[model samples]
Target: MTRESWRTRLGFILAAVGSAVGLGNVWRFPWMTAENGGSAFLVVYLAIILLVGVPGLLAEFVIGRRSQRNPAGALYRLSSGSKSWGAVGLFGVVTAVVLLSFYSVVGGWILRYFLASFTGGYFGSPGQYFGAIDFGLPAVGFHVGFLALTALVVVGGIRDGIERATKVMMPAIIVLLIALAGWAVTRPGAGAGLSFYLDFDGTYLRANFFDVLGAAAGQALFTLSLGVGTMITYASYLGDDHNLASDGSLIAVLNTGVGVLAGLVVFPLLFATVGELTGPAAAGGGPGALFVSLAGAFSQLPFGQPLAVVFFGVIVLAALSSSISMLEIPVAYLVDEFGLERRTATAALTCLVLVTGSANALNPGLFGFVAGTLVDLMLTAGLAGFLVFVGWVLGKDAVTEFSSGAGSRVRSLGPAWLWSVRTILPLFLLGTLAVNLLALAGVSLF
Candidate 1:
């Protein structure tokens, strides 16, 4: 059987951007921003994306394009058949599964909202509606429905499925979001929300530096779709003519733009309706809170039913785009390592996620732990492993791969990029990981 590759550079870029810009941008980014001092979190998040996210992304690309294999195979082959390093790659594949298990439940929630918008089902009492449906048989039913939608696309193969779908979804998401943002900023009380999002607070940033740093770093990795081998899996489909640095940089920029745009829509809607940025409705209640808050906001606005339809529709697309990437990671592993057909691999994994995601949908405590703390730790640790392999295992060869298919200016930064991956990046990631683990254990470092 022949392996599939993306048909065009444009297709690969769009697919990558789609992978990066998902519910992480639309849902989690706003919640994290609101919880972590708003603009203060934004400042640290942007810095991490620039300094850590891009470099970490390129490391995965180097491993993928060089080996032209899934994350496990890439690491194994690159390290001259080292089972240990290959296990690290396999860990990434597991992280993707963990990601989708919770992520699909949220996707289901978005789907319910998208459908309900047309009928204004939740408009009367958004909070009660969410509380009733958030965990139970209804959540499970929607999760399965959402998982089915994700499976439908992945079974289509690279060009015919993932690439083609993202090309359409990415553009629609951007245009709709811009339209929404345009409308949102014009609302009666939007300026307060905008001020909260855009205005910097240096004192808050400094005082909560460690706490914010840990949260910001996790959000940065999560938003970029790093550390789960999604980037590595996606890049494995690339052709050599594509420039890794330029492509990676563009993905980061586009992903960050979408995240900021989501906040513009979310925060303004919150302030425009609720008139404040605190409490469970604003940020505290996690994913469930965000849904209730937005649903209530849409109910209060004029033409809100139509606007809710459009807003939830964008989220449905964004959710599918990211869910497909997460599903693709494990599917790629099965195909590359076990020689399973794509359809068979996708079918098997879809069933697995149906069970796991149902557990998330039915249990709030499990969902919160997996979605918030566990994901952050896994992604941080996963990225750190990939960077160490790139720096120590691949070494100079990693630099060569990083320099492939690039202009003179991009090529010049290869050594520095490699050096950082080898030293600075690993240290930073480990520090971040330690902070997160400490936080998880109820120990405050600051």
Candidate 2:
């Protein structure tokens, strides 16, 4: 069979943006901002996206396009049959599975809430409702439902599946989010939420600099969908005529912009109903804070049921978009490396994740460990390995790949970009990994 490619450049861009703009943007970004000095964390995180995230994205793009292969195939082929580099690609394949295990569980929750909205299922005491339904056999069922949706699309292959789905899903996601954000802003006393989110808190930044930096760095990488070879896998499908640097920058900017937009929708709704941010609601920055607070906000508002439908509907699209990308990494590996049929690849991996994700849905402790700390460590390590490969192994050849379809301006920055990927960037990623590990171990290195 011949290799499949995206039918249009917009399809690739939309799919890239879809992969980047996931639960991280809508769920994690607000929580991370609230947990670590609010606006100050936002500023630092934005800087990291530009400096670290974009360069890392380019490094992945170069590898994928040059090799035109999956992460494991790309590394093994690029290195002339070196097992050591192949190990890095193998690591990415594993990380992708680990990611989907927990991610599919969360996607399940979002889908349940989306369906519930149409029927006013959780309108009475939304916080208690979330507490009741967050985990158990019901969560397992929902997780299966979400994973099934993801598998269905990916089974269709690249052109007939991912590219076509994102072309429709991406537009619907943006339109619905914009409408929700606009409605959220017009709520009574929304000014407070906007101020709290946007106002710079310099004192907090200075006092918790290292803590904030670690959070910002982790979030920057997570929000961009880096470190998992997702970008590399997608770029492998690219034709030589596409400009990766420009596309990479555009994806970064759009993802960040959507994150800011999500914050506008979430924070204002929380403040509008809850009167003010307080205690765990402010400090705990993840699914718990998001589901409870947003549920409460919706329950108290007129026309909220429909609005809930729209809100969670957008989240469903966003989550599916990202989850599909995660699943694609391993499927691509199977097809590219072992010559499995695309449907066979998708089915095999989907079966693997169904069990893994169900385990996460059944246990809170395992879910927390895998979804929070384990994922951060794995992604940080994975991206660092990718950068080192680009910098040390691929080096000049990496530069050549980067300049392949880039224009004059992007081409001009190739050397400096390659330099950063080689030296400072790997050290920076290593520092990030160390800080996170210390924090996990209660070492307080920062």
On lDDT, the leading prediction is 1
lDDT of candidates 1 onward, in order: 0.92, 0.90
Ten residues in a row with the worst lDDT in model 2?
Answer: 277-286
**lDDT of each residue in 1-446, candidate 2, tens digit only:** 67888999999999999999999898888888878877899889988999999999999999999999999999999999999999999999999999999999999999999999999799897777887888999999999999999999999888888999999998998888888889899999888888878999899999999888888988988888899999999999998888889999999988899999999898888888776754225634456778877877888899989989999999999999999899999999999988999989999999999999999999999999999899999999999999999999999988888888878888889999999999988999998898888877888754
Positional deviation of 264 in candidate 2, in angstroms?
1.1
Against the true structure, candidate 2 has what lDDT? 0.90
TM-score, one value per model: 0.98, 0.98
Candidate 2 positional error at 25, Å? 0.4
Across 399-431, the per-residue lDDT of candidate 1 in tens digits comes to 888888999999999999999999999999998
- Candidate 1 clashes between residue pairs 3 or more apart in a chain or in different chains: none
TM-score of model number 2: 0.98
How many clashes show up in model 2? Answer: 0
Which residue segments of model 2 deviate by more than 4 Å?
278-280, 283-286
